[model samples]
Target: MIVRVIESDNELQQAFNVRMEVFVLEQKVSEDIEIDELEEEATHFIGYEDMTPIAASRLRFVEEYGKLERICILKDYRGKSHGKELIEAMEATISAKGYKKAKLNAQTHAEGFYQKLGYTTVSGEFLDAGIPHVTMIKEL
Candidate 1:
């Protein structure tokens, strides 16, 4: 897997396509909700397999930490450790930007995965886009 920060509009579009497939199409998330205004302020990342995008995520600076958002791996790419790699790469990217901490609102079902990556749940269960989620944080 080749994961890198998306530096161009074309690359951003590729990442968006992957998120659309995983979130909008497969998970039935509303298209209106999946694409947000943060795209302009956040730094995006894309994971590619043999030159084709297979995963996507974004990081945005909050008050004192970087917020990880829109993490998605396509259905066909689900079983591997690509999602973990994506988060790791995102961490490296944000860390390079001088962030000492990272946070995310993880889907409840995926909380264990984030826990395995050293994130601790910091908030009680909540709903985002009608999906159960919990806020998690980790030190970079």
Candidate 2:
């Protein structure tokens, strides 16, 4: 398994494909909302398994910290810890930039998963793109 920042258009497209399958198709999130204005400014990462892209995530430097967003693993790759790998790669990029913390709005159902990865809830449940989520943060 290999996870790294996207360095080419092909790699970026692979990340989009995974996100599209997980967020747009499976979760019913509108394409307009899932693909947002942040793409050009955010740092993107893609996870590969034996040369196949299986997961992706994005990190954006927001104000004082790094924001983790658009993290998803293809349905066929679920339960394999690829999501964890994806997030770690993003956080590594954040830490390399000298950020002291990282944050993300995690879907409620996956809060515990983020918790296990050292994130603590900072905001009560809220709606984003019609999904129940909570802000979580971790010291980098």
Candidate 3:
């Protein structure tokens, strides 16, 4: 997988397409919530296998952390380490931007995955977009 920071409208759209498939369609997250106002302020990332978009995520500077959001992998591409690659790319970008830490509200089911990537749970479980999540953070 090749992960790239989205730099064009077309690339951003491709990232959105992957998010729509994994979040809105598969996870039943509302379209209104999946695509939100913070989009314009976030730096987006998209991963491709050859020319096919496989994963996507976004980062926003929030307080003292780089907030990771909208992370997803296409159904057909999950469990192949593409998700890890996408995250590492985002973390690299965050560090490059001078952030000392990274944060995310990870879906409960994916908490272990984030843990393996060096994130530690920072808050009790809470509901977001109708799904259970916990705030996690990692020092960059």
Candidate 3 local Cα displacement, residue 57, angstroms? 0.7
Q: Whole-model lDDT, candidate 2?
A: 0.91
Task: Give the poorly placed runs of model 1, Cα more than 4 Å off.
Answer: none
Residue-by-residue lDDT tens digits, candidate 3, 8-57: 99999999999999999999999998999999999999999989998999
| Model 2 bad stretches (over 4 Å) | none
lDDT of 1 at 98: 95
Per-residue lDDT, model 3, residue 107, is 98
The TM-score leader among the candidates is 3
lDDT of 1 at 86: 96
Q: Put down candidate 1 lDDT per residue, 1-140, tens digits, no spaces.
A: 99999988899999999999999988889999899887889989999999989999999999988999999999888879999999999899879999999999999999999999999999999989889999999998
**Model 3 stretches astray by more than 4 angstroms:** none
Model 2 CA lDDT for position 139: 93
